[model samples]
Target: MIEPAARPRATAAWLLLALLAAAAYLLGLGGQHIPKNGDESVYMHIARLTAGTGQWLPLQSEIEGLARNTKPPLLFWQAMVAGSWGEAWSLWRLRLPSYLYTLASALLVGALAARLVARPGANDAPRPPLQVAALAVLVYLAFFSTYRYSRPYLTSAPETFWMFAPFFAIAWSPARVLGSRLGFPLLAGVALGIACLYKSFALVLPVALALGACYQVAGPRGRGLFVLRRAGFWSDVGRVLLAAIVATALFALWFVVDPAPAEVWREFVVGENAGKFNARESYLGKALAGSGSIWGLIPGYAVNAGLLMPVVVGLLFAAWRARSGADASERVLWLWLLVLLLVFMLPSQRSARYLVAAMPALAVLMVLHWPRIARGWFIATLLMALLATLFALNVALGVQALEPSAGGYSAGLWLWLLAMAAACVAGLVKDGWTRPVAALISAAFYVAFAWVTAPLEGPAGRYDDAVIERLRGEAVMVPSNFNGDFERYQFLLPGARIEHYFAAQPVDFDGLPALLAGHRFVIVQRRVGQPPCADERAEACRVVAARWDIRSRQTNAEIRASLLRAPQDFWFAREYLVERLAAAEGRP
Candidate 1:
């Protein structure tokens, strides 16, 4: 335990460390290498549309007749506000809010951990609460999912923060509320309401389950019977209900304010919410079918938690050992984890990102129970770390050997692996400090790993300013049959008017010539061994431009041919041809 006088200094040290961690996370955040994923493109499109139209209510999308109210308007509003920062919208500007949200969430994790550690009846032999809290923040930022999805223009980071914030507020409150102040409950309600506005009303499930578990363990109980006869218990229940009502009211404000209330109801409530659950062809349904069972989430959860899995397993074992003597906080933590897992499992569309809300509780529980974990568990965790470090080193060296040019990039990874291996060995050799040492090392390795791999987004490609400049005022046509590639092109070609034709349909091929006559440029896909143009009718479409290959290695004809021969074995290189149709046809 840290003395009260020393606590301030310890906290300051931890804050400095946390700030450093934040900087690592934010390194190259706005780099051009960070390509926009499909989700980011959709959100960016909607945000741009909102910014252009100035429609605060009944959120709209770039796609005509499509409403963007499937999720709440908060993220779009945030993106719109971020986009307004400069004259031109950029990826960094759009993703700024998510970065801030992620930082705030990390800080909140530390605060929550500190609060849980400071509670009465916490483990006597535990490390200082500040140390534990700092470790929790480190563990969270080190998570692979946190590195991947947290900084993107996504709802996971903000949603996780909002969901956990209310629990922290209520759980950290004084043991008893004697007056009618309703402070904690009101704070919880407001947080929950904002979360709902950020994403969906489904957030109510996890919050309710967590609060109920808190009540079960903390509320007064009679001998051999669970009773809620006390005034405080009833007051707590009423406050929770009030919170729910407040959230509902906030959620309903969209319908009342939107000029097209019917559109909001039909699109959001019926189409987005109910439709997702009912339609077997929806994304959720397809995921459930593809996964084979709900248990598919187990592996995903492990991967998302990253290096913390060993600690999680150890914590579980400790909880099982102390099940009979578990305190209110322990019960709440366990219930929170179980409830989050179960609720997410119920959804057809399950993702590791969805489980992020449970990470803070898991971090706190791991810290609270670290002192009780067996030596064997720590040894096993160390062994796992060692194996992981060795594997990373092998892969990095192998890649360097295969491609001499990649040696520069792989050197950093090799160094990180070496450092991780040393840390693991030190932890194994040390006594009474194995867990803390291992945790700190693991955190450092993950941070380094995220930093080294941040440049990997290069392969995903970005908007080519040269391409856009060349075809500034021209209309471009592309095949509508392909997947999300068109959407990406649409986003990149902001100034050019892009139209699509059903090239896959034989009946539409007859009209291809007429379509080409009207458009100056036509973007078409060309597979290896096939003619550059789709058919002889497209002979007038002479290739004038090609898609940019953003990968590290320059692709050649041999590689393209091989990928085309085994399309199922690999994602074939997509070479788009930008043809000047009118010029080829010798038209003025």
Candidate 2:
């Protein structure tokens, strides 16, 4: 068994690892492309409007000319910061907050792991070396979905951060109750309340807390309360509840006074959440979230984000030991993990990242099993990390073998391997803080690689950089064959009023002539369905598309359309849509 005397050093090592991992991400991965999912456009637009007008716009808008509004305004408020800063939002500015939240999450996860695995209140159970904490964080970052979706611009990024922050609060600082003295369980409530604003899944946290409380109050732990004859137990429960109420009130306040609150409420709360229970087309519905299958979410999460195989394999043997006789805190963490698993099970919508809130829990679980990890297994993991970094670097930098005669392994690969081997030998031999030093070096190397290579990988990031350099106009519209392209565009373009015209939306094409009549430049994707020109200038319209095909040179092509008569057709159509959408909600 690990000695208590070594605890502090171990804990320090993990902390160091977290810092190294975060530093790498900040420097190397900060400005990569964030895909423009459909919702991002809406959030980006709303934020621009909210920031500009300083008013909470209804969470309803015209999308490519269709009058539709769903989803809460919380994420919009996040993006609003980006929009309010200028005519066009800054990519770094808009995304930075999300990144920071993610980093905070990493810190929280490391701390929680230390709390769970370290001897509680021992103050000397050889605090987990910072290397262990760093390893946990690194393993988490390497996990697919959490790393991808944790970028600051995605609504998921904010939601994930807020949701997890409460778990951290519960694990690290349990006494900062917001309402106990004032009126209720305010501190806990506020943390949870903000999470509720971020997304619907946040509600699960309170449920978890309540269940935990119930278990404590009714089960074996209750003996303490009765024996003490001190009402602190009851008082603690009251404080927690009061905190919940305050948080609820704060979140509800956002919905209570707005002129269109009812509409926003119905669409966001009822339609977005409740409707998912019925509407198949809704985001969390069958198509998006895998609604009906018995093993839908778990498998999807595992495959999409690669969580299943690694985590499951790592923890398999420890399963019985973990569940049979673990401590209360360990049991609580297991419950927390279960709650996360169950929460996503029924949502008609399921994405790998939807389970991101589980990262901390998973991190803790892994650390619990670390002592039992065979030496061979540890070395294999290290080899994998090194390989991943090498492959990623090659992909990002277009590095190829120096000698054509050489197989996949080139001089660079051999050199890197040798350097890693030398480091590993040194780490193995060092008497003090060897693991911490090795982990630091490893995390730093990957971070540096991520920073240099991610920038040139996609057009969205490239365009964002280009736009920042050349801010000639108000908005930049990048044509997309698919909706995913926009996240990066939104992340990059900052505050530019974004308008999309897609072949997928024929009306956008039908109305294209009018949409571009006043605009000089239009960003178009390759596969976009071309609209027929109505006037003599039809021949002049240019077309530009990204050439992903090797023979085509993967270029972003643009076409210039000739001037046409100011079209009156689409204005009537748009106004008609606006009226129809307004009518659906009985809007004046």
Candidate 3:
């Protein structure tokens, strides 16, 4: 048992961990710009519509002919609440809830660690429960996915929290409430229900597996037969059923209450959920064949977890080495990790984010076995840190050689690189406190890396408020053939009315004059090696406003050629603001 005096220190350690998470997730949050992608914009648009419409049932968007019922109403509701709190709607305000969710996830991990470590069967010989818990929090905060997706208005952070909440809840339930009743299991069901409301019914698989694993391990000799023999086992089974029923009922509420159930059924149930799994080209397949393949997930996982993947491997190896002696809690955690991996791997739409549901369990297991794996962990930490420093220096050198004025190659970046190098050296020197020190240093490195290298929308040159201002309150025509660039336009010019042409039909230059009869402005892409005006009919429109150095929407072959031909030149599209001179002049 933990001593009375040690409790305060443990509390302090938890507080410190919370502070580190807050700093990592919340600091410089508003300063960084949103990515130039449709995902972020799409959510933002839905949120804006939610706030404007206040109906909140259908999950609509501002863009015409677009209805988004793919995701549930929880995130959109959170975004609406966030939008209302601040005076003006900003990306930071929209994303504030995600930061809080991320912090809560870290706290939950820490709490779960504390619980497991304090248990009688935990391997606490190598380190104290408090120390292990602290390391777990650090590991979570330093994860590459935590750093990347934690600050965005994405579903990963909340989904990760809700899915893992039931495990801890069920574990701590028997102690908090009376046995053979509907206390903890019911609560676990509610947590699962909330997760379903947040994402989808897919979460049910892992939750069921975790609860089943817990039941199996809770029995004598970790056997399923013994668990089946117990009277309380049936009660536990009832509780799990209760949880699933509750989760299912809550999810069904959407279908019951929504104004357009058919749309939800078609869009969400079929398009998003069913379509994702049935697709022949899985995300994993695309990764392996298109870009890097199966090996890519390694670096992807490492980078997402703050380059502590080697430590994860070491912990796994250590756990395997000592598997014969693992206690109930360790077995449960391993089962949780395995179940998540198995369920996620079966789906075609695999991503690193999909594996985030298992990270908290992985962090706890790693900390539990840290003492046995300290040497390997330390060595891996140093090697990763060294590699990171070398890579940073190489990139800095490359930027200095190619573009001396590049934003990333600055004095501040150099200082951060040196600081990372110093921390790695300190970890190598400090023998007794190496693990904690490495955790602290690695967390700091990721925090610094995030703040220093956070991508800004201004650098992309995709959206210019000034250019957008020119078209404010005016109807703008966009080619339906252009991918999702129009979403960016809608984001920039929220007040401007937008209409799509050639949506169902092919682009006909002869019909340009008739299409521009009523519209004064049309946004079109000017591809490289193509004339500004494609044909004679297009000559009626003259360029009124153009933003150079914007990324081009072209095929891979063209992009590759452009990169090869003009290595130094910015490979961006020149966005043309074409005005129909005839229409503007009211000519016949």
lDDT of each: 0.63, 0.49, 0.64
Show where candidate 1 strays beyond 4 Å.
1-17, 31-38, 64-67, 119-121, 124-126, 177-181, 220-233, 279-292, 297-303, 374-414, 417-465, 476-577, 581-588
Each prediction's RMSD over C-alphas, in Å, is 6.3, 11.4, 6.2
Q: Which is the better candidate, 1 or 2, if ranked by lDDT?
A: 1
| Cα lDDT tens digits for candidate 3, 191-246 | 77787877887687777866766765653323555557755676666666777888
TM-score of each: 0.77, 0.67, 0.76
**Candidate 3 vs. true structure, TM-score:** 0.76
The clash number for model 3 is 12
Candidate 1 has a TM-score of 0.77
Estimate, for each residue in 216-259, the C-alpha lDDT of model 2 and write its tens digit. 53333233636346345555555556666666776776677556
**CA shift of 89, model 2, Å:** 1.8
Please report the candidate that would top lDDT against the real structure: 3
Output the worst ten-in-a-row residue range by lDDT, candidate 2.
570-579
Candidate 2 lDDT at 393 equals 48
